[model samples]
Target: MSNEIINIIADRPFNEAVQDKYFERVEAQLTEVFARPRLRSFAKSGGVLAGRAAETIDASVVGPSLVVFEERLSEDDKQDALDSQAFAEAVVNKLPAETSQEQRYMAYNEALSAIGWVTESYTYKKYDSKKLTLTMNDALLQVLETVISAGSGNVLSLVAAGFDKLKGDKEALKIVDAGSKESSVVSFKAVPCIVAPGGGMAMVMGGLDVFSKDYDGDFLFFTFKTEGVHLFQAAGIRKFNKRAFDRKRQQVYNYIDQFGDGLFKKIAG
Candidate 1:
């Protein structure tokens, strides 16, 4: 059987949840300073960049504990997980009073809190008896997916670099095409763009998780652009700042930082 999965879209103005200007500034600076070297390294070494894995979830126990996984998920089996969360209740209650910008903010927060709650509570338990593996080509696709998911730099830069590498190598293309059959690909559709060298872009499908996790119990297929893939990271930070900062300068800084990290993490990851 397949492992269950849940999707969560976070609250807007995400930085506001942990409001600190200095934290914002430092984060931006770190991202900018690191981005170029990271991209160069990725290009030189191929696209298998490393990222600092987020604090690990204790998968060891969860991996084997079907009993525990079942018990934890019993309630979720019946309802839309967010519907039962306190955050969702609060957001719904606040909806009628959402007259001011601040109230709208609260509503947004409530929604995000609900999402986080569901994602954290939900678990994907991989049974040892149901083990799966990807071939080298499939493994490479998973690596591409991971780079896109955790990367902290510009989407265009990453996409451009990633593409350049892939296009230059027949081996990479073979891996990507074969891997796509075994897993859910980060589905990206083409979009028009004027800024990209090739005058086009691509968007990830099924959202970021397309790159964030393994798919089909075997391979993982990450999204990339033949041209405008770098925009993905930029777009993420831009979305965060659009709702987070009241100040325009702060918003701009956040965009740069967020975009930079997207690229940085990809190469570094």
Candidate 2:
């Protein structure tokens, strides 16, 4: 009889804690963005769309089960969360005299901090003779905008465009019949190579592992009416501000170069 070796532990080079924290941050922001009523309906309807493989996250639609998670946060439920976030920022600006509930307040506080954005309330903190002004550091505020615009210009624009299209077609997207389902696709990467060999959109679905690492994607489905699907890169070029993207990319690279101390190599995605 042959003996088998025991399980081997794998090396994890990346900081898992940092990764998880960022994932939560990204997921929360996406959820808030998708809570827009029109998007909620498009996602929940489980519509289909033509798409190509080309990014960190592939087609707008992926596995079937994601529709369930997409449906979990109803518009009314998510609105409460958004309102709480705004209220938390308001409270910070107001500087209430006493500390509030530890858990709830901590969550809201963390959410705002994660965004690194702050609006300075005109109200001042007065000391008998003088008033003190507090706000997000002006320099840091610019950095925040750089990071946000980088994301918004690239990935977020595609998302926003998809939802905008879905909103227009809501009346037609019931998702019950096969005919409607076939018409729901988002058509992500529409290139000559993808269309050649008669594979079309179906070819993209087969090689999906190349495009998306995530098992479930962020969309449902759809057909087009003057809304031609294009390459995310091409779309990014058209819809996003190139100067802004370059600036942000440079800023990020500069940060790593200045402080990496040889520990950091590069940023991948």
Instruction: Give the candidate number with the greatest lDDT.
Output: 1
- lDDT of each structure? 0.26, 0.23
Report the lDDT tens digits of candidate 1 across residue range 1-269: 24423223433334443445424543554466433333221111222322412321111000000000111222222111212122222232224432432333334333433232211111111212111432222322332343233542353343444434434444334433442343332322111011112321111211121333233322223322222121111011101121222233332233323332212221111
TM-score of each: 0.22, 0.17
Cα displacement (Å) at residue 16, model 1:
3.3
* Model 2 CA deviation exceeding 4 Å by range: 1-74, 96-142, 149-151, 154-269
TM-score between model 1 and native: 0.22
Candidate 2: residue 254 lDDT (0-100): 28
Q: Where does candidate 1 stray beyond 4 Å?
A: 12-17, 21-269
Q: On a 0 to 100 scale, what is the lDDT of residue 27 in model 1?
A: 50
Q: Cα deviation in Å at residue 96, candidate 1?
A: 44
